[model samples]
Target chain A: MTLDVLAAGILSGGLYALIGLGISLVFGVLGLMNLAHGELVIAGAYLASLLVVDSGWDPLLALPLAMAGVALIAYPLQRYLLTPLLRGDKSAPLVGTFGLSLLAQALFQGVFGTHPKSLPASYADSGISVLGLRIQTIYLIAFALTTVLCAATHLVLTRTRAGSAVRAASADPATAAVLGINVSTVYAMTFAGAAALAAAGGVLTGVAQSFTPTSGLPLLLTGMAVMALAGIGSVGGVLLAGIALGVLQSASVQLFGGGMRDVVVYLAFFLVLAVRPQGLFRKAATG
Target chain B: MIRSTSRRIHALGAAALLAATAGCAGNASSSSGGKNDDGGPIVIGTSISLSGTTVLNQIRDGYLLAVQKVNAEGGLEVGGKKRKVELKVLDNRSDTNTMVQQVRSLALTDHVVGLLGSCCQQNIDMQGQADALKVPLVMGALPVELLPKGKGYTWDSFQSLADGAKDFYTVAAGAKTDKKTLIVTNNDAQGISTGKLWGATGKKAGFTIAATKAVPTGTTDFSDVIKAGKSSHAQVLIAAMAPPDCFAMWKQMKALAYKPKVAVGVQCAQTPGWGSLGKLGDGTLVQLNWSDTAGLPETNLIVSKYGKKYTNLTDLGSVALGLHEATILLDAIKSAGSTDADAINKALAKSTTVSAQGPVKFVDNKSVTPTFIGQWEGGAIKQVWPAKGGSPLASLTGLG
Candidate 1:
C-alpha cells in the first residue's frame, strides 16, 4: 500500500482505539460487557451536535462538555442499574446494556429526526502535508488527541490513589469491599471514566465522519474487535490493536479491493479469537 | 401430580383455542381481495423505513396525503359503494428481514387488498413478498431497471435508470471535461446494477471508463478509490452509495484533492441532509424523479399542503413520488370496482393516471417518470439540466 493509504489507515485507527478503549476499560474492571458503549460514543456525538451544530461552538470547545454530559449519564446507570445486575444473573448486564442501546437509538431517532448529522469544522475536510506525506487534518487531530487520552487513561490507572482502589476492586470486589474501598463507587467511577473517553472519541468521529442514530452497531463491532484483539486491561495494546486493524483494512482495500476490506478484517478478527482466545496482546490481568 | 398436570394441559389448550377464535373473530371482516360485507374502510397497508438509515418520511407523507385527499372526498368508490381508505403503516427500521416479515403480516394477517412500497433496495425485496402473497403492490423510488422480473403483483412508477443516465450524459455533453469517468458503487444489488447501467450508458455517450470499484455499505475510508481516480485522471465521477458513505467520500475527495470536474452522487446526494455538508455539497448532481418546474399534475396541491415542511427539491420530489404511487394504486382500486387483488393487479396493468410526477402509464409493469438532473447550489438543489426554466451548470467549487 502507498504511504498515503497507510497514513489514513493509521490515523483512522486512532479513533478506533479511542472507541475500543472505553469498551475495554468497562470490560476489564466490571467484568460486564457494555453493549451500550457504541451508543455512548454516538451519544457523545449527538450531545456535541447540540453545542456544535446548534450553538455554533467549536467541536473542540464542546468536546469536554459532551464527555462530561455522557459521563454524568453513564455514572448513575452503572451505579444503580448495571452494577446491581452484576450481582444477580450474569447475563442481566448484557441484556440491560443491549436494552439501553435500543432505547438510546430510539431516543436519538425521536429527538434528532433520523437525519445523518456531523460536526462541522475548518479541519473536517482539509488536509496537511507532513514529511511529504499528506493526511486529513481532522484525523491528525483525532490521532494526537487519542494518544493523549490513552496516556492519561493509562496514568490514571497506574499512578493514582484512585487507580489503586480501582485495581483492588477489579481484582477482587468482595475483598476490596471488606478493605473499605467502596467497590460499587469504584465500579461506577470506572464506567463513567470509560464513557467520557467514548464521548471524546465520538466528538472526534463526528468531526471526521457523518453519523446516524443506528450508526453505533458498526462502531460497537469495531470496538469489540479491537478489544478482542488487544485483550482486557492493556491500554497500549488497544492502541496497537486499533492501528493493526486500520493497517489491515487499508492493506486489504489496496490488495483485494474495497469489497474485501471488511471481509479481511473480520476474518482476521475471527482467526485471532480462535487462535488466542485470551487475545494477541494479553498482558498480566490488571484486575 | 400427573392428574394435576393433565388438567393444566387441558386448561392451556382451552386458552389457546379461545385466543385463536378471538383472533379469527377480529379478522372476520378483513378480506384479501373480495367485496367487503362489513362496509368497513378498504385497508391498504405498507411497511416502510420510517426511522432508520434510509428514512422514507417523504414517501410516507405522500401516501398519507393521497389517503387524506381520497378520504376527504368521502373515500374510494368500490362496487357501487363509497368506502373510506384505511392505511396501515409499519416501520421496518431499514432491516430487510423485518420488512419481509412486516409485509407478509400486512398481506396474510391484516388481509389488505393492496400494498404500497418502501424505498430503494427494500422495494426490490418487497416485490418477492408481493408476488408470493399475490397482493397488488404499487411503489416508487426504486428505478424501473432495478425492478427484477417477477410475478405481476408489483407495479413500479418511477424514473428509469437508463433515462436518468442518458439525461446525465446529455448534461455532461455540454460540460468541459475529458470524459474519463470513474464509477464507484456500494456492493448491493441496487448499487451493482447502478454501476453497470451507468457505466454502459457513459460508454454510449463516448465517455471512457477509467476505474470502477464496488465497496460495501458503511465504508468510511475512500483513499484507495481516490487514488484510483487520481491515477486515472478521471474528470467525470459517478458514485452510487448511501448518504453517509457519500458524505465521507465527499469530504475525503476534497481533502485528498482529487478534483473531478463533474460528479454525480446517485442515491446519495439526494438527501436533505446533504445540505449539512455546506460548500462541500455544492455542485454535486443528483437524478430527480420530480421537479416543481416540470409542471406535473397536482404540483400546486403538494406545494400548498407540504410546501412549508419540505423546502428542498429532493424532499419535494420524494413527496411527489409518494403522491404519484398512491394515486395510481387508488385509481386502480376504483377502476376494478372491488377490493379483489387480481382485479386490482389487472387494473394496474391498464392504469393511465396523472399525479405529481405527471402522466404515468404502466408499460411492462413500469411507468417511466420524467427525469430531471439537479445540482446542489448554495444550500439548496436547483434543476440545472433540461435547460427549460432550469439553472446553468456551475463549477464544482466544493471540490476545490
Candidate 2:
C-alpha cells in the first residue's frame, strides 16, 4: 500500500478506536447500550464549535472547557437520570438512551439552527512530511493522544484502586456490591469516563472534519461497528478493530466507488465476528 | 379576527382574479387560436428553498423581484388580451424528497403554468417528477446529470455564464508543474457528482488522476486528504465541496506549505464566504455560470430588489440564480396567456426571452443554452471566459 493511504488509514483508525473505547467501556461495565454515545460526541463537537464559531475561542482552548461541560452533564445524567430507569425492564436504559439521542439532536438543531458551523482551528491543517508521506500534524497528534488515552485507561483498569473497582463491577456487579465496592458509584464513574472519552473523540473529530447536526448517525454507526469488531471492554481489541476497519473502509472506497465502502466494511465486520465473536485478541475477564 | 378577515380577502381576491383571467383567456383564444398576443400577464409557479440555508431566501427574492419588474412594465402580451402575471410560490424546505413532492404539488395541485427555482442538484432530480407530469421545468442551477433528458418535458434550464464543467481534459491536458494532483470530494451526492464530473473532465484534460479521496462530510480533520495530495505530488488540488471544507483545506494547505500553481475548486467558490478567504482565495478560479460584476442590469436590478426583500442586501450568489428562474417562469406564463400547464409548457418550449442572466433559449435533449465561467476578483465575481461575454482576462498565477 502507498504510504499516503496507509497514513490516512492509520490516523483515521486512531479516532475510530477512541470512539470505540467510549462505547465499549459503557457497554462492558454499565450493561447498558448507549445509543446516545454518538450524540454525546456530536454534542461535544457542537459545544466546541459554538465556542470557536460564536465565542471566538480557539478549538484547542475550547476542548478542555467543552470536556468539562460534558462531564458535568454526563455524570448527573448517568446517576439521577439513568439510575432510576435501572429499576425497570432491561430495555429501559436502551430506550432512555435512544430518547436522549433524539433529544440531543433536537436541542442541537434548536440552538444551532441547522447550518454548517466550524471551529476554525489554527492547527486544523497542520501536517509534516516524512518518508515521502505527508502526515497531517493533527492526525499524528490525534493518533498519539488516542494511544496515550487508551494506555491510560488500561493502566487505570489494571493498576489503580479505581481500576480494581471498575474491573470488579464489570466482571460481576452483584459480587462487587456484596464485596462492598460501591457498584452504583462505579457505574456512574464508568459512564462519566466514557463520556469524557467521547468528548475527546468529538473534539478530535470536529478538528478533523466539518460537522453538522445530522452527522451523528453515521459516526455513531461507525463507532458501533468498531466496538463490535473490537469486542466489549477490551481496550487493545478496540484498537485493532478500529485500525482494521479504517484501512478496509478507506481501501474499499479507493478500489470501488464510494457507495460500496460501507457495505465492504460492514461485511468485513460480520465476517470477523462470525469467525471470532469474542474478537481477534480477546483479553481474559479481569477483576 | 384578523386572520379570518385576511383569509376571506385572500380567497375572494384569488377567485375573482382566476375568473377574470379565464374570461380574458377565452376571448384571446377566440380571436387568435393559439399564437401569443404579446399582451397578457403569465402565471408561473416556483418551489424554492425559502427558509433553509437563508441564502435560498435571497434567491427566492430575486425571482419575485423579476416578476415585480415585469408586472410593473404592464406584462408581456400574449394573443390579444392584457393579463396580469401571478406567481404561485411553494417552499421546498431544502429536502430532496420534499422538493419532488412540492414540484408535483405545485404542478397538479397549484396548477402553476410553468416551474422555476431549482438551484441545488439533488432538488433538480425532483424535476423527473415534474417531467412525468409534463410540466415545463426551467431550472437555472443544476448540474449536467440532473438536466432534463430525452423528452422535451424538461425545458430550458439556463446558466448565467458558460460553464467549463464538461471539459475534464482541461485538468488532464494542462501540463502540471507538480507531479501529484489530489481530488478531494465531500462525501455527499453533490460532492460525489462533482468529483465524477471532474474525473470525466480530468481524464480528457490530460492530467493523471493520481488519487481520488473522499473526506467524510463535516469532517474536522482534513490532514488525510491534504497529506495524501501532498504525498502524491499533486501540484493541482481540486475540491468538490462546500465553503467550510474549503476553509479547512486552505488553512491546512498554508500550514503544510502545499503550493500549487493551479489549485481550482468547484461549488460555493463564488459564495460570499470565499471573499473572506482574503488572499488565500486569490489565485483560485472556479467554473461559474454567472457573476454579478458582468454589468448585466437585468441581473443587477434583480439582485438589488432581492437583497431588500431577503437578506436586506443582495450579495449572496445563489440569490441571483433563483431570481433568474422566477423571471424565466414568469416570461413563459405571460407568453402562454392562461394558467394552463400544457399551454405554458408549449410556450416555454418555443419562447426565447432575456433573463436577468444572459440571453437564454432552450435546445434539444431537454438542455438549455450552454454555461460559461466566472472568477472572484477583488471581492466581486467577474466573468472571465469566452472572450466576447467574458470578464477581462487575467494571467493564471500560483495558488499559495
Candidate 3:
C-alpha cells in the first residue's frame, strides 16, 4: 500500500481511539455500559455548533466548552437518573440509557433542526505535507490532542488520589464505601469524565465530518469495535486498538476494493474475537 | 353538582369523538361522497421519509405545495363533477417497512384514489405494494427504469441514469483531460446501476475505463479508491454515492493529493452539504434534474413559492420531482372521471401533463426527463451545461 493510504488510516485511528476511550472508561471503571455514549459524543458536537455558528468562536476555541458542557449534563444525568436505576437490574440502566438516546435525538432535532450541521473550521480542509506525504491538518491536530488527552487520562487513573478512589470503587464498591469513599459519587465522576472524552471525540468528528442528530450510531459501532479489540480497560491498549481499527479500515480499502472494505474489516473483527476470547491486547492475569 | 359535571364532561367528550370521526370519514353521511367518493374531494395519500438518514422533506414540501396550489384553484374536474383533492400525508420516519404499512393503510383504509411515492428505495419498495393493492402510485425522484417492469399501476416521471451518463460524457468531451476514467460507486442498487451505465457511456465517448471501485453505504474510507485514482492516473473521476459517502471520499482525495482533471459525483455532490467542504469542493460536477437557470415550465413558480426553504437546484430537483409527480396524479384524476382506484390506474398510465420539468408522459409506466450538468462554484450551484441557457463548462480547479 502507498504511504498516503497508511497515513489516512493512522490519522483516522486517532479519532477511533478517542471514541473508544470514553466507553471503556465508563464500562471498566463505573461498570456501566453507557448505551447512550454515542449520543453524549453527538451532544458535544451540538454544543460546539451553538458556539461556532451563533457566537463566532473557532471550533478549537469552543471544543473545551463543548466538553465541559456535556460533562455537566452527563454528571447530572448519572447522579439523578441513571444512578438510581443502576441499583436495580442492569438492564434498567441499559434501557434507560437507550431512552436517553432517543430523548437526546429529539432535543437535538428540536434545537438544531433536522438539517445536517458541521462546525466550520479553516483547518478542517487544510492539509500539511510531511516530507512529501500529504495529511489533513485537522486530523493531525486531532491526533496530537488525543495523545495529550490519553496521557492525562492515564495519569488521572493511576497517579492521582481521586483516580485511586475511582479504582477502589470500581474494584469493589462495597469495600470502597466502607473505606470512606462515596461509591455513588465516584461512579458519577467516572461517568462524567468518560462523557468529557466522548464530547472531545464529537468535536473532532464534527470538524472532520458532517453530523446530524443520528450521527452517533456509526461512532458507537466504531467505539465498540475498538473496545472489543482493546479488551475493556488498558488505556494504552485502547489507543493501540483505535489505531488498529483505523489501519484495518484503510488497509481494507487498499487491498480489497472500497466496495468490500466494511465486509473485510467486520469479518476480521469476528475472527479476532473468536480466536482470542479476552481480546487481542489484554494481558493474562497471574494468581 | 359533581354528578352533573361528570355527565356534562362525558357527553362533550363523546360528541367531540363522534364529530372528529365523521369529519375524517370523508363526509360519508352526506351523499356528496365519502372522502374517496367521486362526489366529494378525491383523496391521495403518501408516506414520505420526513426524518432519519434519508430525509426527503424537500420532496414532501413539493408535494404539499402542488397539492395546496391545486386546492386553491377549486380542485380538479373529474367526470364532469368538481372535486377538491385532499392529500393525506404520513411521516414514514425514514423506515421502509413503516412506509409500506402506511401506504397499504392509505389505499385500503383511507380509500385514497391514488398514491404518491417517496424517494429512492422506499419508492422502489412501494411499487410492489401499489400493484398488489391495485392503487395507482405516482412517483418521482427515482429513475423509473431502475424498477423491474411492473404492472401499469406505478407511473414515474424522473431523470434517467443512462441519460445522466450520456450528459456527463458529452460535457467531459470538451473539457481538457486525458481519456482515462475512474468510476467509484456504492455497492447499492442505484450506485451499481449508475457505475455500470456511466462506465459504458465513458467508454463510448472514447475514454478508457481505467478503474472501477464499489463501496458500501456507510463507508468512511476511500484509501483504496484514492490509490486506484492515483496509480491509474485517471484524468476523469465519477463517484456515484450518498452524500455522506461522497463527503468522506472528497476529503480523502484531497488529503492524498490525487486530483482528477475532471470529476463528477453523480448523486453525492448534489447535496448542499458539499458547500461545507470549503473551496476543496469547487469545480466538482454533478448532473441535475432541475435548474432555476434552465427556464423549465413552472420553475419560477416552484422557486418563488418555496425559494427560501429549498434555496438550491440540488434540493429544488427533488421538490420539482414531487411537484411533477403530484401534478400527473391530479391530471389523471381529472381524466379518470371517477375516484375509483381502477379507473385512476388506467388514466395514470395514460397521463400527459406538462410539469415544472416539462411535458410528462408515461410509456410503460415510465417517462424520462432532461438531465443538466451543474458545478459548485462558491456556496451555490450554477447550471453549466446546455450553453443556450446555462453558463459555459468551466475547467476543474481548487481541488487540491
Candidate 4:
C-alpha cells in the first residue's frame, strides 16, 4: 500500500479516538453506555452548520461553540433525566439514551431537514505534503487537535481535585457518598464531559465530510468498536485503539477492497476481544 | 470449552449487529396522511415510505396531484356510474416489513382497487406483495431492468437502464477526455445493473473500462475506489448509487485529489440534495428519466401545478414519474369498469396513456420513458444533451 493510504487512515483515526474517548469515559467511570453519544456529536455539527453555512463564520472558530452548546444540553439531560434513572435500574439509562437518540433524530429532521449538509472549510478539500508524504489537511488538523484534547482530558482525570472525587465515586459509590462526595453530581458531570468530547468529534466530522440526521448510528457503531478495543477507563488506550482501527480500515481498503472493509475490521476486532478481553493497551492485574 | 462457546456467541452477536445495521442506515422519518377529500366511493390505497433514507415526498405529492385532478373530473366512470375516488394512504416509515404489512392491510381490509409502488428497492420488495395478494401495482423511479420479469400483477413503466446507458455514453463520446473509465457502484441489484450496462455500452461507444468497484450501500469510504482511479488515471467516472453515498464519495474523491475528466452520476445525483455539496458536486452529469423541457403532453400541468414545490426541472422528474404511474393506473381502472384484481391487471397490461414523461406504452408490462442528460450548474441542473432544445454542453470545472 502507498504511504498516502496509510497516512490517511492514521490521521482520520484522531476523530475516531475523540469519539471513543467520551464513550469509554462514561462506560468506565459512570458505568452508563450512552447510546445517545453519536447524537451529541451530530448535534454539535448541526448547531455549527448554522454558523458555517448561514452566518458565514470560519468552521474552526465555530467548533468550540458547538461543543459548548452540546455540553450545555447534555448537562441538563444528565442532571434532570438520566441521573434519576441511574438511581434505579442500570438498564434504564441505556433505554433512555436510545430514546434520546430517536428524539434527537426527530428534532434534527424537524429543524434541519433530511438533506445532507457539510461544513465547508478552506482546508477541507486540500492537503499538505511533507517529505513526499501527502496527508489530508483536515485529518492532519484533527489529529493535532485530538492529541491536545486527549492530554487535556488525561490531565482533568489525574491532576484535578474533581478527578479524584470521580475516581473515588467510580471505585465505590456508597463509600464515596458517605464521605460527603455528591456521587450523582459527579456522574452527571462525567456524562457532560464525555458529551463535550463527542461534540468536538462531531464538529471535526462535519468539516471533513457530509452528515445527515441519520449519520450518527454508523458513528455510534464505530465508537462502540473502539470502546470494546480500548477496554474502558484508559484514555490513552482510546487513542491507540482509534488509530489502530483507522490503520486497519485503510489497510483493508488498500488490500482487499472497499466492500470487504467491515468484514476485515470486524474480524480483527473479534480476534482482539477473543485474545485479550481486557483490551490491547490495558494493564492486567490478578487479585 | 467456555472460551469456545463465548467465541461462537461473540461471532453470532457480531453477525446479528452487522445484519441489523446493513443497507438501511438512514432512519429519519417524515409522515404525510392521504386525502380522500372528494368523499368518493372507490378507495385506492398505498403504504409508501414517507420518511427514512428513501424519502418519497415527491412521489406522494405526485399521487395526490393525479388523484386531485382525476377527482375534479368527477372521478372514473366505472360501469356507466361515476364513482368518486378516495385514497387510503399509510406511512410505512421506510421499513420494508412495515410496507408489506401495510400493503396487505390496505388490499384485504381496506379493499382498495390497486396499489402504488415505492422507490428503489422497496418497489422490488413490493412486487412480491402485489403478486401474492393478486393486486395490480404500477411502479416508477426504479429502472426497468432491475425489476423482475412480468408476473401479471406488477407493471413497471420507468426509464430503461440500457437506454439510459446508451444515452449517457453517447453524451460522453463528445467530451474531451481519455478513453479510460472507472465504474464505482453500490452492490445492490440496481447498482450492479447500472455498472454492467453502462460499462458494456461505454465500450461500444469507444471507452475502455479500466477498473470497477462495487461497494455496499451506506459505505462512506471511497479510498479504495479512489486509489484505483488514481492508478489507472481513469478520465471517465460513472457512479450509480444513493445520494448519501454519492455525497460521501464525491467529497472523498476531491480530498484524495483524483479528478475524472467526465463524471456521470446515475440514480444518485438526481436528488435536490446534490446541490448541498456546493462546488464539489458541480459538473457531475446525471441521466434523467424525465425533464420539463422534454415537451411531453402533461408537462404543462406538472410544472404549473407542482411548480411552487419543485421549481427545478430535475426535482420534478421523479414526481412526474409518480404522477404518470398513478395516472396510468387510474386510466386502467377506468377502462376496466370495475375494481376487480383480474380486470385491472389485464387492463394495465394493455394500458396506453400519455404522461408528463411522454407516451406511456406498457410493452411486456414495462414502458421506456425519454431519457435526458442533465449537467449540474448554478445550484440546479440544466438539460445538456439531445443538441436540439438542450443547452450547449459545458466543460467540467471544479476538479478540486
Candidate 5:
C-alpha cells in the first residue's frame, strides 16, 4: 500500500509492542498469565489524568509518575495477592488475575464515572511529515517512546544482575531459590516492571485515543496476541511481533476491508499459534 | 515426549486463559427484578446501559424524572385504580447479549407490564427481545430511521436520521465547500444503515459521495479512510462511529491535515466526552433530539430538575428523550386501563403522549421528533442550524 499507511502501521505497532511487553514479561517470569495487565495499563492512563486533566500538567510530564504509581500498586498485588496464589493450584493464579481484572474495572467505574477520557496535548492531534510520508504526531512520539522503553527493557533483562536473577527464577525457581536467589522478590519485581511498561503504554494510549473503564479488554486481547506471536521470553521478539501484527492489520484493511481487519489479524494469530506453538521469534525453550 | 506433552498443556492453558478472560470481560450482571404480585405497583422494567463505554445516565435520569412526575401525581389510573409505578432498571453495561437476556428476564421472570429501551444499538437489540416476549417496549436516543422492522412490540420515539441528514445537508448547502463528502461508519448494523441513509440523503441534497468506508467498532487506525478523504479532496465529512473511534479519527484527521470544511460525526461526536478533545473537538456537528430553544413541553421542569446535573444540550436532549419515552408508555398503560400486555401493546400503537420533547404519536412504530443540528463550541453544544432559534454557523477550526 502507501508509504504513509505502512508508516502508520509500524508506528501503531510500537504502542502494541509496549502493551505486549508487559504480558510477555509476566508470563515468562511468573508462569502466571496475568489477566489484570490491561487494567494496569488503563490504571496508568487514569492515574495520569489526575495530573493532566485535573492539574493541567502535560501528559508526558505525568508519564513516569503514572508508571511508578502503577508499578507501585502492582508490586504489592503480585507479592501479597498473586504470588501466594501461584504456590497453590495451577488454575488459581489465572482465576485470581481474572477476578482482579473485574475488581479493577469496578474500581475504575466507581472512581471515574463511566465516561470516555483523553489526555489533551498540542501534538495529540497534529501531524508531521517525514521525508514524503505523513504521520500522526502522537503516534510518532508514542513510537519513539515505545522503542526506547523496549530497548531499555531488553538491556535490563539481558545485561543487568537483576536480569540474571530474573532469568534464574524464570529458568528454575526452586534451584534459583536454593542458590540464594529470592524467587518471590524477583517474581514481584518482574511483575512490577512489566506493569511499569504497561503504564507507559497506557499514558501514550491516553494521548493517542480515548479510554474508558472497559477499554482494557481489547487492549488485553491485543497484548495477549502480541505475546502469543512473540513467544514467551523474547523482548525484541515482542517488538517485532507487535509491528508484524500492526502491519498485518493495516495490510488486511487494504486487501480485505476495514470490516475484516480484526478477523484477519486473529486468523493470522491463530495460524501462527497452531504452527509454531512456542512463537515465531523465540529460538528455543529457555529452561 | 515429556516436553511435547508439556507444550500441549501450555497451549491448552493459554487457550483456557483466553476463554476465561473473554468470558469475564463484559462484567455483565443484573440487579434483582422484584416480584410483580397482583395489584402491586405497576412494574416497568428497563435494561439500560447505565455504565460501560456508552453511558446514558441522562436518559436514565429522564426515565426516572417521568416516573417521579407520574408518581408525584399519585400514579397512573389502571383498571379504575391508581397504582404507583415501579421502574426496575438493570444495568446491561452496554453489552447487547446482556441487554437481550435482561429484557427477556424482565418480561418472563419479572413479569413487567411494559419495557423501556436502552440507547443506540442496545435498544435495537432490545426490540427483538420485546417482540419475542410480546412486551411493549418504548425507547429514545436511537434514530427513528435505524429502527429495524419488528413485530410491533417496539416503539421508537426519537429524531429521524433522514431528517437530521437532510437538515445537516441543508446547513452544508450554505457552507463554502466542494460538495464532495467522505462518509465513515462502524461496520455494525446501525453504523452501516447510518452510512447508507446519510449517503442517500447527502446525494439527494446535491452533495457528492466521495467514499464510504465501514470500520469495526474498536478500530483505532483510520489511515486508509483519511487517505481516501485526502485523495478525493472531500470537503464535507460524515462519521458515524463510537466515541472512541471518533476521538481517534478526529485526532488522526487533524494530524494528517485532511481538513474537511464541514465535519459531522453523527452518533460519535454526540457524547459529552467529545469536549475532552478540547479545541480539537470544536466545530464538529451533531444531531440533537431536543433543543431548549424549541420550547418543548416540560422544558422548565427539566431545567429546574436536571439543569445543574446536565448542562449540555446533547445530554438535555437525552433526558428529554427518556422523559418522552416513559411518558408515552405510562400514557399507554393509562389508556389500556389494565396491565394486560396485548392491551398495552394496542394502546401504545395508538399513543399520543406529550412530555419534555413535545407531542409524540407513533405511526408505524415510530414517532418523529424535532431534529436540530448542533455545533460543538467552547465545550458546549449550541444549536447552529435552522436559522430559527439557532446561532450562526462557525467555520471548522478544529481541523486546523
Candidate 6:
C-alpha cells in the first residue's frame, strides 16, 4: 500500500542492477567471474568517502574521482598481477582474482579498521512529499542518475564504434582481431567500464547505507547472484533479475519469517535456474 | 634421646624437599621476570578491539584514560613495592582468533603479567590459555552463560557482570505489554542469546508470540519480517540486531508506512551508537547498564578530562567499564603481593571495584554489573529504569 516503499524498492533494485551489470560485463568479456567486484566497489566507496568526508568535496564531484581511482588501481592490477595468470589457464585468472579480492579486503581492513564512515551531506536526510508518500530526495536523485548511467552504458555497448569492438571481442576475439579491431584495447575498456560501473554503484551505495571495508563481501556475493540469476552477458536480463531479486526479497520478508527469507529467495533462484538454465530473459543472440 | 634424634633428622630431610618445591614454584612465577622487591613497571596486556566497532573504541579509550589517570596519581603499591602500572594495548580487530593470538604474543613476547580481553562472550573460550599458563584475565562484557554453569574459575578469568541475560530479561519483562511481539535477531552468538532472553521475557511481560525471526548480519531487506508482522498484527517489534541493520529496518518501517503499537528491542532502543539514524531511531527503546547519572564520580571526571580526544562518542558506561578493568587489575596486583599470574588471578577473584558503573562486585556471573537502562530521547541518551538512584523514568511514547 505504501507507494514510497515501492519506489524505494525499485530504486534499490536499480542499484543492484548496476552492480549486476558490472559482474555480467566482466563475465561476458573475460569469460570469468571477477570475485573482486565487491572490493572494487568498496574501493570506489572509500575513495568517494575520503573525498567528501575528509577533503570536503561535493559527493557528486567525487564520483569520477572514485571511478578514476578504481580504474588506475584496476588497470595496473590487471596488467601486472592478473594478466600473467590469464595466460596460464582458465581457472588461474579466477583463482588469482579471488586472491586479489582477499588482499583488497585485508588492505581495506588494515587501513579503515572496519568502523563505517559516511560521506557528509545534508541530502541524505532531506525528503519531500510525493503523492502523499515520503520520498527521500537522495533516493530520487540516485534513481535518476542510475537510470541515466545505465542508458549511457547501453548506448556505449551497442551503438558506438568502441561498443562494436567490445561486442565483437566478447563474441569472438580472433574474429574481431581479423576484422581489424584492437582486441586488447576492447578487453581493457570492457574491464575499465565494469570498474567504472562498480564505482558508480559505490557512490550510490555511499548515499544509501553506511559502509566499511567488510561491506564488500555481501556486495560481491549479491552482484554474482544477480548476474547468475539474469544469465551472464545479458544486459537486459541483469536489469530484470535485479528487480526480480529485490521484489522477491521484499516478498520474502513480508510473508515468511526472516529466518526463512534468504532460504526462500535462494530456493526460487535454484528453481529458476533448473527450469530455464539460460535464465528467463536469456536470448539466443543480440539483434 | 634416640627417638628425638631420629625425628630431627627426618624433619631436616622433609624441610630440604619442601625448599626444593618452593624453589620450583618461585622459579615458575619468575619465568616472565624476577619478582623484584621494589616493584618495577608492571605491564598489563590488553587484546581488545581498539578500532573496529565504535563501541569497542569507546571502551578502549575509556580503559586507556583510566590507566593514564591512575599512573598520574601514583604507581600501584603492592607489598611495599612501588611499580609503575603500564597498559600495553593491542588492537585485536574484533576477531577471536586475532585476540587469542594477540594474548599469546602479549604473554610470551611482551611478558605481560595479566591480560584483558574483548567484551564478546564468544571469545571468552580463550580463558583456557589463561588457565593453562596459571595467569589472570579480566574479561569485559561477556554473557554469564559463556562461563560454565554452576561453576567458577577463580584462577583464570574474571567477569564484570554475572547476570547479563537476567538484565536483558528484566528490562524486557518490565517493558512488554499485552501486544503480540515480533522478535528479530541477527545470526550471531550474541544475537541468538539476546533472542532467547527476549523471548522468555516477552511471555512474562504479557506479549503473545507473533513471529520469531532471524536475519543474517548485514541484511538489507527487512520487508519479509515486516510483512509477517503486518499479517500477524504484531503490536511490538523486538530486534536483536546491530545498529546499522536496525537503522535500515526502521527506515523501511517508515517507507512501508507500517506503524504498529510500538517497536522496541536491544539494538533499536538500547544502543547509543545508532545516533547516525537520526529521526529513524526515534521511539526505539534499548536497555543498557551504564549511565552518567548512575556512574561514579571518577567516571564523570575521566570523561570530562578525556572527552575531547575522539570524534566519536565516549559513553559513560564504556569509560566506567574501562576504569573498572584498570582498578580491578590494580587491586589484584596489590592483593597478590606479586605480579605472578596465579597470585594476581587469586586477587582478582576476591576483588570488588567502585567504578563509574558503580559498585561491581563479581560473584559467579560475569555479565551482570551494577546495572541500569537507557533510552534515546530527542537525540539525547537518557536514563530510564532502575529508579532507585537515577532520574525519573521516561514514558514510552509515539509508537507505543
lDDT per residue for candidate 3 within B1-400, as digits (tens), equals 3444345445545755774464346223112224676376788888887655667778877787788889899888877767787788776767889888888888778888888988878888999999999999988878757766877788888888778888888888888888899999889766787788888888888999999988898777666778788899998999898776777777767766788988898877887867766677788998889888888987888888888887778888888888888888888888888887888788877777898788977788888889899988876789888765888777777464
Q: TM-score of model 6 relative to the true fold?
A: 0.78
**lDDT value, residue B107 of candidate 4:** 79
By DockQ, highest first, what's the ranking?
A: 5, 1, 3, 4, 2, 6
TM-score of candidate 6 chain A against the true chain A: 0.91
- DockQ for all candidate structures vs. native: 0.37, 0.11, 0.28, 0.23, 0.39, 0.09
* lDDT string, candidate 5, A34-109, tens digits: 8998899999999999999999999999999999999999999888767777876688778778878877887898
Better-scoring candidate (lDDT), 2 or 5: 5
Please, what is the whole-model Cα lDDT of each candidate in the order they appear? 0.88, 0.66, 0.81, 0.81, 0.87, 0.65
Poorly placed runs, candidate 3 (over 4 Å): A1-6, A53-56, A113-115, A284-287, B1-33
**How much lDDT does candidate 6 score?**
0.65
iRMSD (1 decimal) for each model: 7.6, 11.4, 9.1, 9.3, 6.7, 19.5
Off by over 4 Å in 5: A284-287, B1-40, B52-54, B79-81, B95-111, B132-134
Q: Share of real contacts kept by model 1?
A: 0.47
> Which digits, one per residue and each the tens of the lDDT, describe model 3 over residues A71-163?
999998888667766776667677668767766876787677665667777777667889787788878888888888988898998899999
User: Could you tell me the TM-score of chain A in candidate 3?
Assistant: 0.96
Candidate 1: deviation at residue B122, Å?
3.0
C-alpha lDDT of residue A4 in model 3: 72
The runs of at least 3 residues in candidate 1 whose Cα sits more than 4 Å from the true structure, single-residue gaps closed, are A284-287, B1-35, B95-105, B108-110
Cα RMSD of all models vs. native, in order, equals 5.4, 9.7, 6.1, 6.5, 5.2, 13.3
Model 5 — interface RMS deviation? 6.7
How close is every model to the real structure, measured as TM-score? Answer: 0.92, 0.74, 0.91, 0.91, 0.91, 0.78
